[model samples]
Target: MHLESVVCFFAILSLGSIATADPNPNQTGSGKQLYRNRHVARQQLLSTTTRSVPPTQPHVTPAPTFTPTTTGSSTPLAPAAYTLSNGEAAIAIIGATYAAGIGGAVLMIGGTAHPLAAGMIARITGGGPNGDTPEVEIEDSNPVTTTSSSASSSSSAEPTPIPSPYIILFSPNATAQEIQSVNSTLVNHAAPNSLSEVVSHGTGLVVFFKAGINPNQADAIRQAPGVGGVFLDETLGVDQLPSSEQAPLSFASRRSIDTDTPGSPKASVRNPADIKLQSDAVNSLKVISQPAGAKLTELPGYGYAEEAGKGVTIYVIDTGVNAINPEWSSMPGHKDILYAPGAAKTKKDFLNHGSCVASKAGGPVYGTAKNADMVVVKVPRHLHTSAVFTAILEVSNDIFKKKLKGKAVINMSLGHLIPDELHSAYEQLLDSLTAMDVVIVTASGNDAEKGVNDVTHYPALLGPTTDIIVVGAVDNAGYRAPFSQGSGIQLNVSAPGYVDCANGKAHPDTQGRWGTSFAAPAVAGVIAVWLSQDEYKAKLQVEGQVAARVKKMVQDLAYSRVEGQPPVIWNGIDPRGLSCASDHPTGFIKVFEKDGVASGYYDVSSNSTTGGVTENIEQWCLAKCTGPCVSVFLYRIRQSASDGYYICNQYNQPWTNNLVQTGVAAADSGVVFTKSLNRRYCNSPGKTVSRAS
Candidate 1:
């Protein structure tokens, strides 16, 4: 291998060139000082080069050495000239030598040196006593400083001299309409020449300009229509930019990392044969396969050992869990946090929406990951502007203020971008949970036509400390779900969630299952399982631990970035790269790199609840708050075991006290005992009793 340059600049002076002349004081002082300073520069440059690379490499390569020739100098450089160290100049010369490959280094040209370049040299080796050597030395020695402008002009003549674009952040609250306004405003303000590209983050948007766009511009937009707030893009900086890969901690700041590595108690990735649907509507539902812990002999768990989401309390801090399943009631520690009273205090499905979610989420013994416990908290929603964010913050308050033991994993299947007092509260709660080390998972959203602009949803935008796992919807072919909200900007990872929103003449899968909203719970369940496993424990944090695990598992299972793409690690996206002007920012999730050469999927959606409300009511009567009639559940059924609502079925299925039916009882209503709990259409529980009607 070739040896690296010994000194950035080696003066090969010929000894024979020296001229014998009488002593000139002015010449002696300047010439003598310059010679000594040059010598010091020589030594330091030699040292830096030698230590830079490995010593094992051969150094047989020929190197030009420095030599000084005697000359009668005009003005002598003062003693201060010796202050500049060789290290300062060497870096400059190297920079000038290789401008294309590396950046950030300043090139100080001589015979033609740029002032800024000179300034950089001076800064590198400065005035302080502690400083290795003063920049005064190099400053005094360079005679051609005046011509620096010309040299820089010459060097810059070549293409690609401009610095890379700065990273800019966008607002999530920005809607398509707002984005246009902001883009126009930015164009009008300074660079009226060109338009700024808007990066859409679905519910939220991020915009980055070729030129710098300060926080003020962001603030200005905040006051504009549909704008939320603006903040600096803090995703990149010098430390995070990459200095020394192995350097001992770059900054003193403390950040959290997911402690749940593979060896830990956490688990990842689980599949099931089928989720047991409700008894009444058997027409459309079918158990293609049983979920984990359902038929253990058939489905089985993913880990080396069986792991269930036992201790981890999963709180769905959005529309509360409608929870009608005998399986939904089976979970222990399941509770509701409806702070808004009659509204958020709902146990009944609001429009039957909550039930559809709980069905797939906390569900029939088969749906709940063998490892997780579920909690459904209803957060009020303003359809035009999703206001459920406060529900999450309220849940966080319970975790932080109450110091709620066994913090729950929050699953928010709903999202909206409206800023108000709710946001302030939301931030407070997320900050606390992130600090407490709780994980929050949210859907990437399901609002894209032909899938182009995918903006990020929040609480998904929580701090780095909080492991806010943003999931996107993916189809069985590993392609991004058309309805699934996407964009590389905010999604952490994707999951299989493509059924179909509503049957459309265009898309037959409509109403079938195709949205990231559904995909989020699966991830929530998997996270719960990982948390329950003895191996994960308190190891993984939401950020470093859980996010990392998900990334690894996705890649390990051969998950590519996109359908026809390569696998990308859990690397954060360049928020600046997003184009708000385009659609489906998160839609780029094709399958970067797959488990096999190609493959895999995710699901989440927004609909007016799927399983139908009436049936859910009957299921509730027979399972959760149902009285003595609870004895006939397919999974497990029994009356309250403790002071709370709970039941145990013949199959040993465990259920909790949830969603008590308003009216109707077994003995009074005559809900026959032939099959345990049965429903009737009469006025009171005592009026009509029908096992088979």
Candidate 2:
């Protein structure tokens, strides 16, 4: 359908449905009839007011030029009187009036007093008690219609008459000359076709005919040899476009702000193998956890204590960081920060969201990795997925061209649900970046309502890949924040997303903000610290193995606690687990569960390596116990061969590595039995051994 027709159809439909409660009894006609009459009168007014152009010539709108203006608030224009057609008096009302609240009065317009139409009075009064009052009372229950011609002129008038342009799509092989030839032949010599200066290259051409395209003409154009398809050229005004592209940013004053002095990391670094929990949340635990209630400085290594993130470049794809501020400028590697060429250098964060996130990642006082350098890629404050995709591609291309693959980590705390068509392109771009060994971290989104219902947010949903880490927000008590959106296989971890905006130097604003947005940067900063480590860099140098092991390494070191389910607290920088690990399946475990007993088959080759390869599990259990108790099959995989794997009881208590054997069941006579392929052979898997049933 044509856009004009569609709009008109909706307008008509809307006008016909206009209803009000307790309409004025004095009203002359139904709203629909009155509105139709007003519309007709408006059409007459437009015909008399507008200047007509030559019918044969195609009208072209000039490109608009914008002049920057000082930012300030302005008062709105008040409604004024306008003369109606048929030389009738039209009283202009500034606001609203109701029937019970309004009474008939002399409507003075142009030095003359005229009695108001019942329709006009009913519209203005909105079925209220009569009284002598000029004051407009706009009730929430019933809206009053102001009879200001200037206000309703545009809405009531008919759209301008113009020949609708057609977008003709040509086959790929069709040349420009052939398209032009077809265009020329489509219209007669007297009525030439008006082709747009902007060509669709090998695809299509926008053509407009003076006489307008009839059904026969359209059919003929469609049947043309190289023409693939034809569509209406639905055009919009420059003003109708999204304001993000048109608006100019007004940056904060260029003055250096206070810098956050660096602090020391935790005294001892923890090893991943020491952590035994394997819940989804455990993948993101830090050694010195961000305390349930503690300042950024108080949290263990929260202030980039680990390697200062040196040699690691954090590509922050956000509202560009306000590096002009001393908090960023005072940093050791602040000089490394960059904005895309030709991008506005107003090193001030207008939205403050970017600066806040950047601080969490690398700002000296507020950051997790104070020493890590950052590339601030300024995007629109209100991000569009396409703009984000473009920015990522550009940054990724730069990283590849400059050979900064494993040396960098990309922090994208912004994303939205996009169309299905864009998903493939978006994922492809991410795959390309990850394939280059760049670590990607993104938020699970703040839309918890949508998330609980299984609405997956993108980029976070882009993978089953280990290269990208999807983080969600967790509270001080280590439970998913009520506002955080995440639950499922895609959620890689959770972190302390809470930040007191009032306390931090990076965000100089009123109150604070929370969500997965803040949580993502915390993870990114830790990755930056990991990247800066000498050992991790050495592992990066040998092929792309390090990128594949990042997820497992994170899970191993994660500090886990069970809420409804376990929530992992993302503490900053665990240097212990940043080792090269392979994905070879080295061993298997057989799970045996009956009654209240939940135990898994645990066996491995004597030579099988620990912490790197996948440990498979085989399950065999009685049908009754298998239904509920077997649902949770968790067996601790110990580092020492002597520490045999054990299972959690029906009570969900932590089981001892070896002594917690022969579990008790809730029902009498239902014996809970547990066994494993002796811990001695686990560390060095000599051969695959079968467990005796």
Candidate 3:
């Protein structure tokens, strides 16, 4: 028993030496001794059982020294490693074993167990196959706060695009099915509520894209069936320039010659004996009738047809018209003023431009065709291409529905520069309207100051076409206005641009407005007057013979004023014949005379019995009358005939016989001598007339 005890004691001493042994003999003794002292303290505090095991080198390299951070600094502390005594290392293994056993119990108790505990056990136990030491990585636990600079840098990765509007025009021959298909494609690719039909006559549409369109999407649309062209929808402005004050008298004061003032002469006096003196104002109205170099005193007042545009309608496609103004209110009925679809409901002229335009066309005091009807088609202040297209379509449809084809005239005092494709679309729409015998008159745009040629402006650009009559501006002296755009070839006619027009304020107030906007309306009024005549109306009703004749007549009768300017528009009256007593009487008067010798009378039945012959009665009288002719009468012997026959008599003296005595004799003899049928002419109020029987 004594010998066994001595061997066991030796073994115990050997095991103690191994537990306290230092594996790295080359390592600094101070670090090893400090680590062992800390392990001993930790082992006493844990109070866990320990087992002997051989020490191994750590798998990871030794980390740098850890430096604690201050409160103001956010730098994380570096991870560190330390050597442990054999006994303390054994105690760590035993604690890890206990944790593994508890984790197994948790797994058996509940199915929702975390894998973190198992993962820790695997990391602690699973070293290299060659028996290398395991490592425990300690990541910095401080929460990180993001900076604004980094956030901004991350946010600026992508960019957004802007939207734009475009117009899609279909081919003229494109079928309705094809148009529908193209529209469907646009709706699929375009932004919501962005597609709209602009002009049904030209088959055009407008669409907007909020997110902007890519090249691929545009190409797809272009490749669609029946798509003629796509163009950017551009905005336009009114054609009027800035207003100026240049009138000598107000509209009310200029309306009549103040008879109360007698010799004071508030206004110029028109020749009472000379018929066709419509207005007393010797301003723009007088100049239209006089020749280029005539003195202001020699100028006659405005001369127009007897019908005075009675059957014609002037469509003023502009801003809007104030129907309540005296210029329009004085007419028989206020019902002549009309608004196009999509135009504003308000009758007030916001810009006061359309009212002035309307006044120059057919106002009671300052107009050309004093009795013509006016239709106001309103547009936005800043005109859009789509809005213009829609307006034109509305006008065309209205005229066709009301059967006011040739009797209608559209006066467009607005224009803008447009693209080629858009120009084509306009041409298509206008061509259609003109085919129906609707005359279109437009202003030569007021873009001369901008160096823009009148031919470059739309509607005016289409002036070269026979159906459209484009007028440029000329001052009162018959010289082209400084701002008037166009060469003589580009413009169809010229008219007084500077004129005393309605100010669109209160009733009877006037302003001296200047621009081609005023000139075009005057020409429109003249066309209205010409159309009111029976001969032109008959020509309009004939198939294939449209407004071309009317357009030619206007151009042919226009007289040359300034050398470089277009011929100024005339009211189709010869100033030389104003005081004449030819067969073409000036006013609405009739005369019938029977010579005592029957051989002196010339029968005109073989020439022309149509009512149209009355327009050229002077020429017929000159050709058919044999001897010295004093008076000519148009008579239809047959009561059933639709037109009258001309009878030129050589009676040079006036006869004083009552019409009732002639009618009673004609009824008893079975011969009907109707009242003399001469072309009716307009006369001023309270004019004396002398009829022969």
Candidate 4:
């Protein structure tokens, strides 16, 4: 069927079913109007069929300066993804009521106002609800109308408009040496169809480098100095059109972020050689004993936990997995969920990476929840902007359609270190999930050293609409892994995942599996455990409580205070050991759960220090430097009424990581801190926070 025809069919169907719905002042005319932008983009693509896939190598060109396209439909000019995916509001203005040649359909912009979007627009353009909005009685439940112009196209044959290229940042800690090194490498290796540009933000610098030449050349650029890392730097056979590009998503671990897969792993234990592992919760367990503990059969005193992963379902939006292992031999259902034109993955999927992740969350091997159901997607480990963005949307569509979609938690172990087109799509997807109260978890990328502490993996950088759960790694001694991304202001909390993926003293698994990639699921598992609790039955409640408590617990309980370290603001470097802002800066947090928390941690890099990655951001922000921690994820903290802990409120602190900051009407007063900062004393109601000098 033609794209227009399909849309018309859906529109008519919708209108017929809603004949009795209330008339909306927010929506003019019938709600069945077709979208003009979708039609325009599709027409553009169809007319310029050659433009569907972008060139392998692309040169950065100035944005085309052209007259705005004439509007064809008076209907909404807004796109569906933003309105449809986000559930906060269902009303919006698609196109201006008075614009010339506007399309006829009236599209409800479809969702609640985006806080960051609102702030950014206000900061940049100065357009927003002003003095006229406050005194007016506004109902929070009423839908809102928004108006925007549609992208231009040459003709009506093409149906979809292209997206403009953009970049988002997590945090950047590149020193002069590192930044210089990265810059030199890219400039020197500049080749065909390649483009590089750096845009610094409050968090870090976004060095956007496009693909050129071949895979080998791309690999070389990926290794450029100052350059932290690169993925598909060029178009994946797709165009650089505006509509085609989207930013990668961010996810937080604070929302009762569960790493929990189906259920804790289980075994029969009929023989005398099995490893004695016990289940603590679904898709979660601990290795109680390992002797001449043959992993294949049962030990004399060991018993197996026969189980199912209960009602929870967890998703892994990475590669596919081996679903037929003995561990999953009895699983009721396991399916592959990836599709491309003439390409679809089947039950016999490929998931070498997925297997490792599953071992920690869902299991055919060992996991937090043995019975937790799983949804596996076979996205490429590395992909071009178009492919990655498309993959993100496709996965979200699947999530919307699945029976287990609402309650399941999703863990994304794969990511790009830099923000790209996929970011926006991922953000919308997470917002969709958040509104439904689905748990989302992601690993902060593995690039922590070489002063790359600030940049994070995809989905890990998304905003609060996700109610996401973000995680970093911790060492066996209960301190943050030097390489583990910190929650300073952009993330949530930590978990005991190490380079080797070990569980306890004397026994380890997956040796050398270091990276935040290996650490995230531990937090996921913890979220799963929390979800099983009575108070956290609702996914939204689980995320909020767990995220809040996580920050509190970690700040108060984790790690021992190291003495005599250089203070963040030592009045003078050696202003000869002059008084400093902090006599002892509490730089680390520890994790503690009820007994039998089904915990696992590895012992490597014992000499590693916590907070290097995040502390860098705190320092940058404190300096009132351009870069500030955009959001804070309070992963864990000590329970209220616990001893010796002073109440800390969330306020905008400036550089030097000191509580004393300037410019805010009241940086020290009450305000909801940005979700990215993960502040325990956030803009949320809490006492002001300060560190001892």
lDDT of 1 by residue, 193-262 (tens): 2223322221223333322332323333446554443432111000000111121221111211111111
TM-score of each: 0.37, 0.42, 0.55, 0.37
lDDT of 4: 0.32
The window of 10 residues in a row where model 1 has the poorest summed lDDT is 39-48
Going through the candidates in the order shown, the clash numbers are 121, 25, 0, 152
Better of 1 and 2 by TM-score: 2
Query: Can you write out model 4's per-residue Cα lDDT over 541-576, one digit (the tens) per residue?
Result: 444244334333323222211121100100000001
Worst 10 residues of 4 by lDDT: 566-575
TM-score of 4: 0.37
Model 3 clash pairs are: none
* Winner of 3 and 4 under TM-score: 3
Candidate 2 matches the true fold with a TM-score of 0.42
Q: Global lDDT of each model?
A: 0.33, 0.40, 0.49, 0.32
Best by TM-score: 3
Candidate 2 residue-wise lDDT, 1-693, digit = tens: 000111111000001211221222112222222122110000000000111123333323221121111101121112221212222333434342211101122343323343432112212322222233332221111123333232232233222223344444454355556565455543321122343222321123321122233232344466656665544432110000111211122111121112121222232343322211111111122322432223323222221233557777888765556655544664555444344322345766544556666766765444556567777676543332323433554566557555776778888776543333333334555665666677888777655533342324445655343357878776544555555665666677777655532122343432244666667787787777777766555644445555566665555545433325334544433333121111211112233333433343322111113323233321111111111222223334444544433332332222233323345432211223223222111111111111111
Model 2: residues with Cα > 4 Å off, grouped in runs: 1-306, 335-345, 381-386, 449-455, 501-511, 538-542, 562-566, 569-693
